[model samples]
Target: MSEIALEARNLYKVFGRNPAQAVKRLKAGETRDDVLDVGTAAVIDASFAVQRGEIFVIMGLSGSGKSTIIRMLNGLHDITDGEVTIGGDPITGIPRGRLREIRRDRVSMVFQHFALLPHRTVADNVAYPLELRGVAKADRRARAEEILAMVGLAGWGDKLPSELSGGMQQRVGIARALAADTDILLMDEAFSALDPLIRREMQEQLVELQAKLQKTIVFITHDLNEAMFLGDRIAVMRDGRIVQIGTPEDILTDPANDYVEQFVQDVDRARVLTAGNVMERPRPYVPDTGGPRAALRQMKDAYSSAAYVTDRDRKLMGIVTDRDAVKLVRKGENSLRSILKPVPQSVSQDETLMNLFVPAVESPLPLAVTDEHDRLVGVIPRVTLLAALGPGPNATEEITLPMPPLPHAEIDAALGGAESAHEASANEVPTIKAPANEGEVR
Candidate 1:
C-alpha cells in the first residue's frame, strides 16, 4: 500500500450544544433523520484514507457533509467525535496553536471564491501563506512568482485581483496555495464558481499541476463528472455518510446500489469507458506455422469468419480469413503467411471508447486492440462497439473522425434495434489474446 497522507476515522459532526446526546442516540441505532429531529448531523461515521500524492475527491449533493468533512480535516471546524491523522500523527484534538501552525506550514486551502486581498498585488496575495509563516520577503516573492508562472499568470504579479478575470483570479488562489509548499491541499469546490469553459480549463490545469507538484489533495465537489475527471479515487457521500468509494470506472460500471446507480446514470459513458472495457477476448489464433486446414479449424471452433496471426512471442503478423484459408489449401499452400491480409484497423487498449466509433464502424473486420509494443491484445468489432454503445446519448453522436466510406448497412444492422450495450458483455470475439501485463483485459 502507498503511504497514508491523511486518514479520517469514524468521523462525526453534530451541530448543537448537546452533541454528545445526539452521538449517543446515533450509536444507539438512531437514523440520520432521527438525529435531524434533535439537531444536525453534518457527518457520521465518515472514514477514508488518502494515499500520498493522490487526488482524493469527496463528492455529493448539497448538505451531504462533504464540506463539513474537509473542514474537520484541517481543524478549521471542531471534530465532535472521532480522530483525524496527518502523516501518521493524530491531530484530532491537538492544541489550537499547534494545529494552526500545522495548517499554516503543512496544509493550504483553496476556496471556491478566489480569496485574494483586493488591495494587495497578485504577488502579495499569492505570497500571503508564506508571509503568515514568517518566510523572508525575497524568498516568498521568488516562490510566488514561480507559482504564478506555473499557473499561466507569468509577469502578472504587479496587477490587482480586480484587474484579472475570474479564471485568472482562481489561478492566483491556486498560486497562493502552492506558495505555502504544503504537503496537502484542501480544496472545497475550488472551480465551482467559474464558467463552464473556465472550469474545464482549471480542471485540466489542476491535473497537469498535480503531475508536477505531486501534492496530496483532498478535493470536495458536487459534480460527478468533475470528480471522475480529477480524482484518483472518489468517495460519494449522501445524508451525512459516504455511500460509496471507488475508482471512476468501478463506480460507473458497478454502482454500489440504487442511489449510486442514479448518481451516475447520466454520466458520459463514452468518455469514461476505455477500449479495454469494451474489448472482448478474441477468438483463438495460431502462429505463422499453422497450415490452411489448421487455421480453418481454429476459426470454425471459435465460431469466427477470420483469425489473427501472431508469432510465438504474440507479436501480431496479420489477419487471415476462412476464405483465404480455403483458397490457400486448394492451391496447396502449406504456410499461412502468404495469405494473411493487412489489419483493417487498430487502436491502443487505453484509447477512449468515444474515439473508436469511427474506426469500429469503418473497419470490415474487428479493430485490433494493441499494446505499446504493437502486439495484439484484443479486438473491437463493429457489433461489439455498437453493442457497447447500445442506443443512448453516447451512441447517437455524429462521427467526428475522418474515415473511409462507411458500411451503412452494417452500421444500421449492428445498432438498429439492439438492447442497450452501454454495459459490457463477457462474450468472446475474434483476435482477443491474453495480455503479457496489466491494463489489458484478460
Candidate 2:
C-alpha cells in the first residue's frame, strides 16, 4: 500500500461537438473559442493528489463538475484526457472487469439518495454488496451487523428502508459503504437531499465516523458551508477548475480571489476562524505599574493603529489608545489606568471567525481571550479582524467584556434571556433549527 491513496494529473473532461477536436486542442493549447464552439470542459486540466487518511472535499456551484470528476474517480464517467492513479496503479484506462475489481475491493461510493433495497431489510441491503462479491451469507450478515452498530443502527437491522426516516436511511447507506471496508470512500452530495437540520447532523456524524475509521474520503458538494465543515482540506472549483485547495482556516481567512471572497463574506466569520489562527504575534513585554499609558505606547509601537493592553502576567487587561492616554494626561490624572477600556468580549478558542461579533461588542478596548481561569491569554484588535474577515463595515459591531469569566446568571442577563425567553445565546454544540421552513429560525 502506497502512502498516496489517489493521484490525478492534468485531467480534462469535455462534452459536445467535435469532442475529438477539444481533445486534440488540449494536446496543442487550450482555446476559449474552440471550447465554446465545441462544449465547455467539465474539468479543465484539474490535478491533485490525496494522501492516505485524508478527507479531500471538492466544492462548487451546480454544474461546476464536482459530480463529473467524482464519476470519473469511480470510472462511471470516462475522462477525455489525463490519468487517475489509485493505490499507486493507474485505473483510468482499466477494462470493465479490472475496474470492477478496484471498485469492489478498493473503493465504494455512497450517493445522495440512500439507494437502499426497498424490498429488503436494512441488514439485507447492507449485505447485498458483499454477497455480489462472493462473500458467504454468514460472513456478509455478520459484517453488516457490525457496521450497523458502528453507524448507530444496531437494533434496527431488520427494519425496511421505507420504515426509516431519510437521515436514518442515509446512515444505512453509509453503513453499507463501510461494510465494503475499502481503501477509499467516495461521497457525492450525500447530504444535499436531507433537510438542513438533518444534513447538519449527518455532517457531524461523518466527522465522528472519520475520526474512528480514518478512511481516505473524497466528498463532493456544491455547498461551501458543508465543505468548510467536513473537509480536512478543501478544493474550491469554478467552471470546472480548482480555484483553491487548503485547510478551512486558510480558505475563510485568505481566499484566493473575489469569487471566493464573496462566499466567505456572507459567512459568520467568528464561527469559522478559530482563535488559534489569528494569534500570530504576542507583545514583547507586559507593562509594569505605569498604567495603560505605557501600554498604549507599546500597542502603538506594535501596529501604530490599534494595540492591546495586558496585566503584569501578560494576561489581557484592557486596551489603551494614544487618544485615551492623552485625554487622561490632559485631565491631570496621575495614572492612565482609568482610560483603559475592557475587552469587548471573550470567545472560545474553537469558534469560527464569523462569530467574532459576539465578543467584540462585549469587550472594552482590546479583545481578550482566556481560559476559565479569568486570565487573559489572547487579544484580537479590530484592525486585525477586519483584515482577516472581509465584508461591509459590520466589523464595527462590538460587545464589551469583563475581567474574568462571567457566571451563567450574568450571561443570561447580558443576553436578555431573563427578560424574554425567546432569544438566548447560541449553544456551543449548535442547536439545530428544525428542518428549514419548520416555523422560525433558531
Query: CA shift at 46, candidate 2, in angstroms?
Result: 0.8
| Pairs of residues clashing in candidate 1 | 282-432
What's each prediction's clash count? Answer: 1, 36
Poorest stretch of ten by lDDT in candidate 1: 422-431
Worst 10 residues of 2 by lDDT: 433-442
Best by TM-score: 1
TM-score of candidate 1 to 2 decimals = 0.83
Best by lDDT: 1
- Residue 36, model 2: lDDT of 76
TM-score of each prediction: 0.83, 0.70
lDDT of each: 0.81, 0.72
Question: Which residue ranges in model 1 land beyond 4 Å of their true spot?
Answer: 289-294, 298-306, 321-344, 372-374, 390-442
lDDT tens string, model 2, 355-429? 775565554444455545655445555555665565457545532323322244433333334332222121111
